[model samples]
Target: MKTVVAVYTGQGLADPLKKVFQELLPDVRLVNIIDDSLIGDVVKAGRIPPGVARRLVQYYRNGEELGADVILNTCSSVGEVADDAGKLIGIPIVKIDQAMAARAAASYERIAVLATLPSTLEPTMRLIEKEAAAAGRAVTLVNGLAAGAFEALNGGRPEEHDRLILETAERVAGEADAIVLAQGSMARMESKLAAATGKPVLSSPRLGVEQVREVLERLSREGEAAR
Candidate 1:
């Protein structure tokens, strides 16, 4: 079985990503590297510190040593680090929100990036902008922060977390052609947000897993051709 190493900055998306992988690529082996403190450090620094980036690169190398066919970086806050790490890592490094950001950039002229943390928000918006620039598409991005939602979720008040996100989405929906949830942890809200806002709502986990599947398939095909 092809091995996928998922490096997470927090535990929020661990179960959800595993579930997505099970549904989308049942044959693949999924491994996780959770560092809950990473997100807190990033939030405190207001950006990814060099030491934090080095630590993440070390984790990616560890995944490589474990024989990962692909590495999934599951934090939008450190997504640019993932991009840089990809250059040094042997296997493909898939940023969890990359596919979602690409889709949003390509499909909508006005996109709103919704996130519970400022650290996640800026990187996600930058990613969408990067995607649009790469595709030569003109896009406008709006940022929406569901303030206190992360704390609520961490406090075990999921209902409050959802409520705050829903409110933020509703308020931003008027300005956006579609809304993109910046964190993989919010994947569960995709359908609900789409239904409530009557617009496309993109989330990372499923799309990221699908992208992993595609990469694995391509690698398999290349292996066969080499034979």
Candidate 2:
């Protein structure tokens, strides 16, 4: 059996993605390694500082050590590290937001990045910008911060968190060609955000899992070919 390990900085992300994996990647065993401090540390430092970056790489390495066929990094804030660590990990490393960013950049000219955390917003926007350039599209990005949504989600009031996200999303929608939810924790509100915004709402969970599946399948094909 192939084992897929997800390294997450927040349980809000890890738990929901776990559920998605259960439904979508049933045959593959899913494991989680979490470091809650990573998110808070990044937020405080306003960037992935050296220590945190080292830890991020180490976390992925540990996943590979545990016999991970694929490593999924579920936090958008530090998702960029996967771009750097993919080869070092010696397995497919799925950055949760890469597919979403590519889709957003290609689908919309005005991309609205909605996040509850400042740290997440910056990296997600940077990811979108890079994708936009790659696609040869000149894009404008608008940042939307849903105040208190993260707190509500963490405090065990997901409904309230969803409500806050919807309200802010409604306001951000008119200005955006499509809306991108910056954090994996906000993945659950895709439908609500779409209905509330009447535009394409992008979240990482679904697309991220699909990418994980794609990488694993591709590796399986190559292995078969080699044999």
Candidate 3:
């Protein structure tokens, strides 16, 4: 069976992707490479060291050796690194939120981004701004960061965490046409947040999975033709 590699900095991102993959790509095998130790405080602080990019490249190389048809990095903090890895390898490499960012810019002129970690919000905003410029659209980006939301999610109070997320998301409701959940983990509350705001909820993991599946399906088709 063909396989794809999905690298994550923490289990929070991987757990959701597993659910997504189960629903979307059950036939395709997935190799999960999770490194929780690297998470540390960098995610909340919103910083990525230069070395992180190199580490991502190494991960991609290993995935290539394992014959992965594609590689996906689930952390938005290392998005640029993920792109860099794509350039280093001929095979497909995907940044988790790229497609979500592009879609968010297209669907909504005013967008609210909800993130648990401060570091994720700014980079995500920059990504949305870049995508909006590429699409020739101007978008208003709003931030909805709830204090301790990340802790709540990781601390095993998902319902409470989602309540806070929905509350914050609702505050930006009238201000934006849609909401973008910056991290895949934040995707857990996407539907609830959308319900609270009565606007479309865009999540990185779902969109990213869809986009990567498109690429991989294309690759599969091309390979079949070549055979």
Highest TM-score among the candidates is held by which one? 1
Q: What's each prediction's clash count?
A: 0, 0, 1
Give candidate 2's error at residue 227 in angstroms.
1.1
Whole-model lDDT values for every prediction: 0.93, 0.89, 0.82
State which candidate, 2 or 3, has the greater lDDT.
2
How well does candidate 1 match the true structure in TM-score terms? 0.97
Off by over 4 Å in 1: none
Output the number of the lDDT-best candidate.
1
**Native-to-model Cα distance after best TM-score fit, residue 182 in candidate 1, in Å:** 0.3
Q: Give the Å shift of residue 210 in candidate 1.
A: 0.6
Tens digit of per-residue lDDT, candidate 2, span 1-227: 99999999866677788788988899999989999998888878988898888999999999989999999999999987878998687888989998999999998899999998888999899999999999999999997988888778778998898888888898888899999999877777788789878999999998999999999999999999999
Candidate 1 minimal-lDDT segment of 10 residues = 10-19
Model 3 pairs in collision: 46-119
- Candidate 3 lDDT by residue in tens digits, 1-227: 66889988787777778888889888888998877755554664458766666676888888888889888889887786776666689688888899999998988899988887777788889999999999999999988777688788778998878777878888888888888888888776777777777899998888888988898889889999999
Best-to-worst ranking by lDDT = 1, 2, 3
Per-residue lDDT, model 1, residue 58, is: 97
lDDT for 4 (candidate 2): 95
Q: Supply candidate 2's per-residue lDDT for 149.
A: 81
